[model samples]
Target: MALNDVEEAHVEDREGNRYFVYEHLAQGSPTVTNPTGKETYRHSLAATTVRPDRKGTPYLYTLNLSCRQDLWDDLQPLFKESIDSYRLVPTTSNYIAPDVRPWQFW
Candidate 1:
C-alpha cells in the first residue's frame, strides 16, 4: 500500500533514544462506517527502523499506532507520547542504537 500525505518527525524516548515517526492516511481494508453511515479512513502513526543481524542482513522493526481519522487529531498527542516512550530492553547489558541508519520501512 502507498502512503498518502505522510508527515515525518523525530522523537525521543525517556532514555533519549531517538526514533523517526511517520504519520499518514492509509486506506483501510474492510472499511468501517460511522454512526452516520459514512465511511471512515484510517490514520497511521508509525515508527520504523532496520536492524541488522550478526550476518548483516537488515531486518525491519516497527511500532504502529492506528486510529480512525475522526479520532486522529484528538489522540495524536497521546499516541505520540506512547510511541516516544518506547524503550527497548537492554540486550546482554544496556539498550543501545549505535548504528542508527536512515530507513523508510512504511
Candidate 2:
C-alpha cells in the first residue's frame, strides 16, 4: 500500500505504558451503484517493544482492527439484541431514584 493512504499514531497510557496504533484499510473502496449506498471505515492498532537506545519512547505492544460504519450500523440492532438477551443488566424490585428537584440541606 502507498504511504499516503494509511494513518499511523501512538499513545501513552497513564502508567507510562505506551501503545502503537496503526490503522489501514484493504483498499480505497469498492465501486457501488449508488455513491451513498455504502460507507465503511477500517483501522488497526499495535503495541511493541521499544529499543532502549531509541531517541523516542516506544510502546510495548500493538493492535489491529477494521470497521465499516454503514455495515456496523446495519448490524448494530442484532448486536444490541444479543447483549440484551444475555441479561447483562440486573432487575431491581426497590428502585432508588436520584434527587432531581433539590438536594437535602444539612
Candidate 3:
C-alpha cells in the first residue's frame, strides 16, 4: 500500500472546515500476466481529516479524482467543487435525502 511521489498540503471548504490534502501516483499489477497491460495515470488533490479520535487511531477521509492526463486541468475544478459540497450525515437507518436528490433515498 505504498504511494509514490507523495506530496501533502492543506485545503478548506466554504463553511471553514479545513483538511489535509495529499497527492500521489499508484500502479497496479495483476495476479496473472497478460499480453495487454493496464495504463497508469496521475491522481491528485486528496483532502483528508488531520485530527484522529482520542484513541489515537488515524481519521483519514479523502475524495479522489481520476481522469485522462490531458483532461486534468479541465476536469479538476468540477471534481473539487463536488468534493467541497460534501456534507456529513448521521449513519442512522431512518435518514432520507432532501427533495433535490430524492432518488438517493432508494
Query: Each candidate's lDDT (Cα)?
Result: 0.65, 0.37, 0.54
- lDDT: worst 10-residue window of model 2: 82-91
Highest TM-score scorer: 1
Off-target runs (Cα >4 Å) in candidate 3 are 1-3, 11-17, 25-39, 50-58, 90-106
- Clash counts for all predictions: 0, 10, 0
Which lDDT tens digits does candidate 3 get at residues 1-106?
A: 3534565555665344566565555543332443232544455656565433344544444567665444678987987776666544423555442433545743
Superposed by TM-score, candidate 3 places the C-alpha of residue 55 at a distance from the truth, in angstroms, of: 7.7
Off by over 4 Å in 2: 1-4, 28-42, 45-60, 68-106
Q: How close is candidate 2 to the true structure, as a TM-score?
A: 0.30
User: All candidates: CA RMSD in angstroms?
Assistant: 7.4, 18.2, 8.0
* Prediction 1 global C-alpha lDDT: 0.65
Displacement of the residue 54 alpha carbon in candidate 2, Å: 21
TM-score, cand. 3: 0.47
Model 2, residue 8: C-alpha shift (Å):
3.9
Q: Using lDDT as the measure, what is the rank order of every candidate, best first? A: 1, 3, 2
**Arranged by TM-score, best first:** 1, 3, 2
Q: In candidate 1, which residue pairs clash?
A: none
